[model samples]
Target: MRYLIYICFLISFTINSQESIDAALINSTDIKIDQIVALDNFETFYYLQDNILYKQNKDGTSINYSNYQLGEMSTANAFNSLKINLFYQDFNLVIILDNRLAEIFKIDFNTAQPYKNVSYVSTGFDNTLWVFNIDFQQLELYDYKTNKTRFSAIPVQSIVLSLESDYNYCWLLTENYLYQYNYFGSMISKIENTGFTQISKSNGHLILKKEDTLYFKHKKKEDILPINLPKLLINQFLLTNETLYIYDLEKLHKYQLKIN
Candidate 1:
């Protein structure tokens, strides 16, 4: 009996001494974080408002140039090279913007059904644009070429709430599920967990929030590592390089990670 007690004590000590693991923090020099962009006294009014995409320069002024909610203002490709916007009033309006937030081009939806529902919008690689239509309970992709719209076949049945696209893949979050779709709109994999308030991707990994817990996962991992967070309501999250920017609807916080 005494021997068994001694062995158990040693085991407990070993377990307690083990180090916790987290995502590796890239070097600060290697991971340059831009200054925090603060837009004061701007409240989001529309439940389904267009992207008031603006760029904050080194001086912290966001040069604004949206059509003043003239139409359904959809996706904001702020990080993309072209920074395009998908606008549809009665027809699909693709508005191109420069870095200064100036309007460049406006392409009207020229189809038999000019007034189709654009549920979601995102940018694609090779200067392509992704248009998500939610008509007849289906999601279709429309690739915008230089001056024309080509219908692509990427079907969706779930209700997409927010979406983001990159050169190779796309990340979409519905009411209760999160999906990773390729550029062609084919579902690669999906995770069904509710209360996913916001998501951001960088360096092939994604950072999301479920309730008050912040979770991080790589591209192919099936499980997520929960990060330590206080009891504060988080409305959105943005991950860049290795830093996680948390927006709590009232303030922003920065987190540095250390993987062991």
Candidate 2:
């Protein structure tokens, strides 16, 4: 009789946990996606397919931008409605595009001084770029117009895993720690790492991934919310506002998150 009671309790606990997880996921939408990006304000989304970049609006209308000379786009960062920076890592070049996907300018890092190799790049304030100079192992604020380094931080010890930034601040994620810095290249905060494969940012919230599970936390808060996903291979994912986007090889899944 005691063994029977224990089995029943285990089943009840399992069902309750599943129910709790279901309550946090409100809705899900699936669509074919190759690469996905969300804007800073969480008001727009962009996806890339077959070397074509598409800007998706709330009404489902999309605008596309393509360049044959740029080759394949490696990464894109939309700093605001006016400026979007795209990088081609293989060619060591960066292109600035307008909201309509029109090209503004292109910079070749080989010609740009003080940087022989850049492992990562992100948009920064006043039409500048936050670049990780792999040769120096330092973070630098590079101005494209003047072709100069505005500010640079001291060399870091570990290799960078990922980087995220907005107009005012930049966040660097290494294997052992996460570092936050202001526009002046001053360290603001440092958080210890615990095995995250990828990281995404929106407002003050951070979404971290490890294996198939995701964890969300506010920069000012201590509590972390764990989100378990269905058994699907995730090629990439992004979080903006309260919405989460998970991408497989051929499809993208959008989910609304209920966070307390």
Top-TM-score candidate index = 2
Instruction: Provide the overall lDDT of each model, using Cα atoms, as 2-decimal numbers.
Output: 0.57, 0.79
Report RMSD (Å) for each prediction in the order shown. Answer: 8.3, 7.1
lDDT, candidate 1, equals: 0.57
Q: Which residue pairs collide in model 2, if any?
A: none
Please provide the root mean square deviation of candidate 1 (C-alpha atoms, Å): 8.3
Worst 10 residues of 1 by lDDT: 40-49
**Tens-digit lDDT string for candidate 1 (155-218):** 5566666766667777777776777768666778878856776676775687777667778776
Q: Flag clash pairs in model 1.
A: 50-73, 87-93
Compute the lDDT of residue 62 as modeled in candidate 2. Answer: 84
What TM-score, to 2 decimals, does candidate 2 have? 0.83
Per-residue error at 33 for model 1, in Å?
A: 20
Question: What lDDT is reached at residue 49 by model 2?
Answer: 82
Number of the top candidate by lDDT?
A: 2
Residue range 1-260, candidate 2, lDDT tens digits: 99999999998886444422221445455667677766335447787888888898877788988877868888888756588888888889998989898988898998876555888999889969999999899898999999989888888899799989888789899888888899988998888878876888877677888778778866676545577567767788777777777777766677777654
